[model samples]
Target: MEVRVLPGEHFYGFLRFYGKGITFPKGHVESGETYEQTALREVSEETGYKNLEIVKSLGVVTRPAIETDGTEVIKDIYLFLMKITGDDKGKAEEETEWLTIDDALTRLMPQEVEFLKKIQLEIYED
Candidate 1:
């Protein structure tokens, strides 16, 4: 998810929409890259924010499906509770909308919010 945190007691998230289906700002963990590394790189590339920090790990999302060519593919994606620790220096295309944290609770799909909340609460923990 591409996010921006205002200097307030609270912050929000932004939605990255490509089409009818919303796409998350993430990528497969590359060779020699840890889960956090991949998350940082993906967020930076997708959102153009350079200073990103993995506040915590969210979890893993796996999709095992058969490719169109008949080969079976198992896609395992790692998720994280990442934060924007730098300036929002880059501008995104018009398709990108700030997915407000409050709105995220309501606008996001149930499973998506549930899936993310499981790991994101760490930011509020002691």
Candidate 2:
């Protein structure tokens, strides 16, 4: 996930084009790619952030959803808090934004919103 601290106090998340709401950089784990490598690649692909430093793994989150085939799908998402090394640059493949955490929450799906809040507490709260 790509996150930027706005003015050193507020947190901003990247909003993707197809994801319907504000989301961190994410993508499938390609064959021959480590999860960490995928995460780094996704961040760069979706948000144009190249120099990333993974702060820590926030672990995995799982949720159930129904696919178009009506099959129950259990999605496991690996969460990471990362910092970018240089000023954000490059053209993203999709529309992207660095929105404030509160604003991002407003644009997130219900389940994702809760997950983001948990991340916020874990990172920002004692």
**Model number with the top lDDT:** 2
lDDT by residue (11-73, candidate 2, tens digit) is: 655756556666566778999998888888887887777788777787776767567799998
For each candidate in the order shown, give its overall lDDT on alpha carbons: 0.60, 0.72
Show where candidate 1 strays beyond 4 Å: 1-15, 18-20, 63-74, 88-95, 105-111, 120-126
* Model 1 per-residue lDDT tens digits across residues 53-77: 7766767766554566999987666
In model 2, the Cα lDDT at residue 2 comes to: 43
Clashes (backbone N, CA, C under 3 Å), per candidate, total 3, 0
Best by TM-score: 2
Poorest 10 consecutive residues by lDDT, candidate 2: 1-10
- Estimate the TM-score of every prediction: 0.63, 0.76
What's the true lDDT of residue 15 in model 1? 46
Clashing pairs in 1: 13-99, 14-99, 15-99
